[model samples]
Target: MGNVFDNPSFFSKYMELRSDYNYNDYLEHPAMESLLPPLKGRSVLDLGCGYGAYAMSFMRKGSSSYLGIDSSSHMIEKARTENAGAGISYRVLDLKSLDTLSTVFDVAYSSLVFHYIEDFDALLRNIYAILSDDGVLLFSQMHPLLTASYGYSGYFEGDYFAFSSYQEEGRREGRWFKEKVVSYHRRLSSIMNSLSDSGFIVDRVLEPIPREEDIREFSQLERDLVRPTFLCIRAIKKKSK
Candidate 1:
């Protein structure tokens, strides 16, 4: 297992989990579930599209074309190998720059990606640039409250089951135990502001409450901690001047 925080593409674990793990209970959130039906026949761009799950899923639904880009060449290679399919393309890309392609998509999306970005402003700005006028953008991410989560401060020794004291930033040091990894947490307000400032219209924010069946499927500990794993969003690019 690589450092999941830093390596955007180091999602071998996630890919395996999500590849065939779509359950209505787990997907009770409309944000992720809604992405499919509307995407049939649409040209789509996926940013930080780790392992190409979401993007490839779109193409599987008969999407016209799919282009997936990510910061992790390692993950991109895996995405290319495992998820490549009809009309789908995967490339190694940096969110701060997307010169590899231009405003050629009908819709775009990303899942659990923005939280890792260091520059929210440059990221949204670049995303806004490649979108066709009024093109839709959908995304999901860890809730901003994650900044206050235990593991962030290195206060926990292991995935909420451990312990530590976060008296200072010095707590962030011990990740060498794994391979490549990097990430940054951002506030929800700041994310919304960045999207707005970058010329997009917010459609809705999806903060889902898991269902009873979900509780039944999760372990007691997971049920308690799985409070909410994702923040789904829908937005549209402002028409070009």
Candidate 2:
């Protein structure tokens, strides 16, 4: 559950998938687009911003300043090497190392990352403390029921939930490794409860229906199991009473 960056394949895949979408400005752009409304004219912190794709999108949306933090060097390398622009920067950081970031942010966003975290409450508090007053936290995670009920991901089908993992042959020779990631498998009520307890007000949650093209491009397994994505979560820090 820790340092998912240890898997080289994930890094390699990160470079390939996200970079392609960043350049294409289409496929992954919607998720990026949905994150922008919260960041307009605000200082932003992008936690687990893989390869800075979402951070780059944030910049294009006119965020005043941006900082991206992730535990993966390979992802950080891709970000700092080519993605930095227009008052945006990337740092290699684990979630627990939140204090290393210098400035409080107006918006903090993450995508497809938090489900891997073992302790969601601690992470949420860390994120909440780092934000400025009324700061919004926008995140997209693997849908718990979707991943739990489905088998594979990526090719969009909006079919069902899936949360399974197994080992494939490694690219490099060595001891076989384990992929031990686990999800919270929560309903919408459970998700809301966690945020409410963490001092956040759940502002909105949107589940997007996939387009017809998504079902066609994907394999049958993806079509069968990949249910609609519980796509966006926008939560605002509780204002002081």
Candidate 3:
């Protein structure tokens, strides 16, 4: 997944898409922000932090330190130049290597990156080990329904949504920016269960709905009313017994 973003053409297209107001800006971010705990004087770890886009924002919110990690060197380089600030640092590290980290954090946040990880259980366990007791873990991913389909068309047919293969979970290959992308699909129950098994206490689950103002601003967002495009979870690391 990280290699796909390293491709100049795909990375350029992705940057262009993010430059505009899209689902991430209007839907995902708002919900994630709402679930965030206090950040003042707390340490933050951002997983799959592309270009360190949210690094400064977290710093501005009074976080004592912020570490943004991504697997793409291109993204880390751009982040160093574009989003760098005091108390903010970027690392070129894959999510799979999280166990290599020894520093504990008060908050761990990820945005739309988990589905690309093949080993969800290991990922959560590593996160648990790196978080202080009762540390907050807030993350979002493509909703199960959206990722369940093998070849998903991001369009609806009249009133019907082409949804299938929900019970089957595994690798799903699709195209993004004319580049082949691979993502793993897991049922919603699996996600919750993995978190529990990793010693996290579920706090909040969100399937964001576009506010009326958002729909008025981007009419295409009305499609989300039919089916959620993203799912957000806020959980806390369970205290050691």
- lDDT per residue for candidate 2 within 93-196, as digits (tens), equals 88777866667899888877776565677888888888888998888775554544322333243323333421221111111123333444455565678899
State candidate 1's TM-score: 0.75
Tens-digit lDDT track of model 1 for 56-95: 5677777899988887777788788888777988887777
Q: Clash number for every model? A: 5, 16, 0
Q: How big is the positional error of residue 137 in model 3, measured in Å on the Cα after superposition?
A: 0.5
Q: Point out the higher-scoring one by TM-score: 2 or 3.
A: 3
The RMSD (Cα, Å) of candidate 2 is: 6.2
RMSD of each: 5.0, 6.2, 1.9
- Most accurate candidate by TM-score: 3
Query: Where does candidate 2 stray beyond 4 Å?
Result: 19-32, 100-102, 147-184, 213-226
Q: What's model 3's overall lDDT?
A: 0.90
Estimate, for each residue in 1-241, the C-alpha lDDT of model 3 and write its tens digit.
3478899998998899899988899999999999999999999999999999899999999999999999999999999999998999989999999999999999999999999999999999899999998899999999998788886533222333778899999998877777787888999999999999899999999999999999999987897988898999999999972
Give lDDT: candidate 2, residue 131: 83
Better of 1 and 3 by lDDT: 3
The worst-scoring run of ten residues by lDDT in candidate 2 lies at: 167-176
* TM-score of each model, paired residue for residue: 0.75, 0.76, 0.96
lDDT of 2 at 49: 77
